[model samples]
Target: MAGEVRAQGAVKSGQLDFPRPLTTVDVVIFSILDDKLQVLLVQRPAGEGEPFPLSLALPGGFVDIARDRDLAACAARKLKEKTGVTSPYLEQLGSWGSASRDPRGWSATHAYFALILADASTLTSDARWLPIRDGKLREKLAFDHGEILASAIQRLRNKVEYTSLPAYLMPAEFTLPDLQRVYEIVLDRPLEKSAFRTRILSADMIEPVAKMRRGPNRPAQLYRLKKNSEPVYFVRTFNPPE
Candidate 1:
């Protein structure tokens, strides 16, 4: 259910600390199809500490061993249940195992991040696609979500500079300029147009489309994401870069 996580293990305290066994998933969904970078959120229905009858949150749930063969698949299934769509790029964010992170005893959760298009009717909660800008998000995102969001953003920004993650958000075919924009968005700063072009072109991950997207003056070609397209290199840092 979408309620509290169940507590597990025996406590010498005598009083029952938590109820049943507990496990959870924290999902971070993002899409970049246009000018904006947006994340999916859902409103909490009434009665699950839901102050707002409809408030924003990520789609997630308890692990269902019966339905899913493994933890990752279980989390993915829960995400689909809550969001109404399947995630194309899902990965383990990290394990959140704590003695008392959950109100229920001995509870733990596994967080996962999903990358998808920013569209309607697909997010988990009451559902809304919120822009990444701080002011754009006024409502309180639920359950350690603030932290989770921050982590996902930092992780994404760091990944895009030299990695192919940008491909995850772009169409199969895209122009070098289009791919560059996604990179700029991730960097949170503009890259010199010429240098940007060289960076991606040299990587050689994208190709031109058969047809072009004609513009006001001339024809602009469309391109698609490459297969198994790993960027030339990744920035490695044991610690978060300053």
Candidate 2:
């Protein structure tokens, strides 16, 4: 019962003994670096005689009802406390509850997925951002976390194909190439630059700004999502690389 949650107050014997399954939250936070996708993981401390002295898993913990007003607040608090990451694009992925998902007791988790800019400087020493390749992660994560992560990855891949959700991963102003890189990273495929440009432009999800990003080479024109551009659904699903 390592991560089990107890009731706040004692239950009366004659009262209706309602089963209150322990509620918790888990976050799968993703970031992009060098056109590659990465996910943040926190190290779980080793207990005496455990086979794995240390293991990695998504940043999460039991929900503190007194401190957290809701499930999302608990997730955000745990993410910041465990990984020092805050203020990213977060969305509920799904609920996970199985008879044997947790070793402790009956538990239900409201899992979330977050998209953030890759910045190692913002993370704690115990937190790491690992690459996502071959449609999977390299580390042997703890508990049912691997399944949760895979679910989040699939959700992101599906969403990016139809929705303008990926814009949350970029800066306030970015070039088309930059946006394409975000897509390529999330989808794990090299996009046809011209075709990608045409598709994105035709959708009119973004608008050109009167700004340019200066670099060693020529300045690149900047663009941002239109303030009132509605998300387009039912588009063609993007194909992943073989």
Candidate 3:
């Protein structure tokens, strides 16, 4: 009787695994260094139908239950194994397990995104940051990474305006000018210095740190995202255009 009840529950919840599907995860690692926004990509080796034998791609792989159901942890583990870098900000951006997203039999991969620390020059083992706008990126990837990349770019742009989340890409202490520079880089435009600073500070999403960053020109006060950080992630309501 209990077994039958459980079976009915599975049906109700759509939790039954009928055919085994190959599960995997792909991550889009991002960072800014030397005044440039760069992404980490792994070079695909010669393979069956992989377009570029030595092309670039984000680090990812199958989920390991032994590592726990933590999706971002799985991505970080795979990245360190494949690219040799353990980042501080790996997150499950969303799930992408559509049937057509993968060419391989019934396999589907979950894509994660991680923000990396600068100084990636040490990532020399077939892992490097090609500019997001690099014209040389024509390599065909394993899954729908091309489409995924496009979506991720839009997500980053949209989140920056309403969320102080971009600060994760910077150090614990940063100046308002530094923060605005990163915003411009991600948005790919020149933000009016006065207006940008005005809106950001008025948001009250960040608070001052005890540290001061000494620059070549002047010493700047450093600040960090405030403790009750929910205010920083405010998403204004919007109705679809009628």
lDDT score for candidate 1 against the true structure: 0.66
Task: Evaluate all candidate structures by whole-model CA lDDT and list the values in order.
Answer: 0.66, 0.79, 0.67
- Candidate that would win on lDDT: 2
**Across residues 1-242, which tens digit of lDDT does each residue of candidate 1 receive?**
32443323444566865454567776877777457778777666677643334546666667776777887887678667756667467767777666545454455677788776554325443566777863134556756666677788877776765577777777666776777787777666766778666656666777766988777877767877666655456444212334
Tell how far residue 35 is off in model 3, in angstroms: 1.8
Better of 1 and 2 by TM-score: 2
lDDT of 3 by residue, 1-242 (tens): 44533443334335662444567788887778667666677887787875445655667767887874677678877767755667556666777776466554456777777666665325657776766653123555556777767667767766776666677677766899899888777766667788667677878878888888886888888998776645266544112212
Q: Determine which window of 10 residues in candidate 1 has minimal summed lDDT.
A: 1-10
Candidate 1, superposed: residue stretches over 4 Å from native? 1-21, 48-55, 82-87, 119-125, 134-138, 229-242
Task: Specify the highest-TM-score model's number.
Answer: 2
In model 3, the Cα lDDT at residue 70 comes to: 79
lDDT of 1 at 64: 70
Model 1 lDDT at residue 109: 71
What TM-score does model 3 achieve against the real structure?
Answer: 0.75
